[model samples]
Target: MKKEQKESLVFGSNLNFLRTRKKLSQTQLAVDLEIKRTSLIGYEKGVQPPFKVLLQLADYFGISIDALMRYNLSKLGEFELSRIDQGFDVDITGSKLRLLVTTTDKKGKENIELVKQKAQAGYAAGYNDPGFIESLPKFQLPFLSRNKTYRCFQIDGDSMPPVANGSWVTASFVEDWTKLKSGTPYVVVTKDDGVVFKLVYNKIEEEQSLLLVSTNRLYEPYLVSVNSIAEVWKFETFNGFEV
Candidate 1:
């Protein structure tokens, strides 16, 4: 058999076993991964996914691509599989964190670009684009540390009260997501949700997700998978505008 065919068989078998072990139906797993049911069915039929999707699945199952592609995970004992899950790194593609993109002044000082309410939708797609970063309005707050990278995001909605709508939240970029403090407010940039400021509860080790809690009692908390998150910024301060 061709190398590609052989590799697909291994991945499909492993994926089938993992999903069944978790007692999750295909539809449920597809929803959790934000993928189509049809595509998931194809994956279980020995069809290899694109590189990005492969990384997403690896993160979703808390396993390494190397192990998923090569090992007969179905044969491994529970203890051994648990070890494999813990051994993987907490990053997309099982690699080091990507370098953060930023804009600086002519004086070589970094500027905190503001993501206004109008620019929120595009922020997720263009965050890494230097042109996009440069186009946003820039300002500096002397009190903020020059050593760390920071960005200002304008928040909307009443989910997090006291901080009213149209409030510009300034936050510092967080590289190591695993170190996120529970109950700390953060600006989490996600693929599906755009950008949201909420109280974060780290559940990466136990469930490979983060529990986002809103301050307002009426709004219910929800879990978002690590793979869907593009960036995390710890809350530094906020500039609320009085209506």
Candidate 2:
């Protein structure tokens, strides 16, 4: 059978199952769908429905047709699934559950995977170990593991509050630090300034410098040269501490 046909069969089976489970007769379902009873029968008999109608039916059922079809049969752990607008995308997939970032854009998928792998490695490297790097004091490095094994941190200081301090945040290492985008929060380290948490503003002209911005006005932004950065932890959404 063609791929589309197979998908349709799966969707049809799921729809039939849900309808039967709800104890809705064909006439009742057809009424709910605003379609003739014969049309509902045809759908259960593996006839393809129009795309718009299919979407409408799926929405009424509160599920993606993709979910109904059971695509991506891999049994991912709970942590690996992130629900996007239309579907649930797997961020991490392994025997042991890891971190995942859901993305539908083809180009974004590559970047998201790269970030996930780096996070996994960093997390395994003593970054999440409590007080493991405390001796380094001024140089606080974040965990790099992609696996969901570390706790989240929340920033409280006005200097980094909006994205860092007040919000729950997670840190993971990035191999390609040059891929860092300005206006995104990062865990940045500098030889002269030590460790700082703020959004990166890399537009300064003097000394190839970048500005670290805080969400709160009480804190002053500071400039750090690009060359001074030791390592950059790409910021992930803060999952801890309710706002």
Candidate 3:
């Protein structure tokens, strides 16, 4: 057999196995690919189609051509799978921590692979170290626990200027409310406004409301109901501050 024919036969067997595992019939696979049933039968029978058709089949099956040919089913579990705009999820369960670097784009317009690559590079460069991560404390709230290695976000707004406008701020999950003191800086997530890193204060005469203060003079402190706040991070340190 020719090289192309041999490669196609290998892919065809793997494709047939995957289809069978998925419990899809040849006719069903043809419908999903928007191809005639006879074409899928020909592919399964070791017949190669044009490059364009092969590419379409690969895309529909969500597998690379090499994977289809080599047929290593074990690697399927390690596949970097994600839905568009859903972001990537890393499970570091046994390690007691997980690093999740979500895209900075709120509109979810960034490419997922590019975002993952950037995040991975940042982590590889020791972005979590004290100097690089501690400088963020002045502008936003830091986490309560100093022991945990937290992931910092690169802030984009001038509203929290001078300290965190263009800096990376580390955030940790807050576990104890009693550890929080009045006038402490924290990253607060509310039910309505999403996340805000600001200093929190207990307002007198209003047990249900607390003060949210911004270090930037242009922004004034505001009151938010305690019930509205979902999460809080007591400020930590950071080193890299461009603004």
State the lDDT of candidate 3 residue by residue for 190-234, as single tens digits: 656655667778542223355788878688888865444544555
Worst 10 residues of 1 by lDDT: 88-97
Candidate 2, 93-190: lDDT as tens digits: 12112233222234322112221222333433533343433322121123444442222334444476545435555666544443557898876645
Compare the candidates by TM-score and give the number of the best one: 1
User: If ranked by TM-score, best first, what sequence of candidates would result?
Assistant: 1, 3, 2
Off by over 4 Å in 2: 1-156, 163-168, 203-207, 240-243
Each candidate: RMSD: 12.9, 18.7, 19.6
The CA lDDT of each predicted structure is 0.82, 0.53, 0.53
lDDT of 1 by residue, 74-102 (tens): 65534455655576432422125356789
**Between candidates 1 and 2, the lDDT winner:** 1
Ten-residue region with minimum lDDT total, candidate 3 = 89-98
Q: Distance from true position, residue 214, model 3, in Å? A: 1.1
Q: Any idea what lDDT model 2 has? A: 0.53
Q: Clashing pairs in model 1? A: none
List the candidate 3 regions with Cα displacement exceeding 4 Å: 1-146, 203-206, 241-243
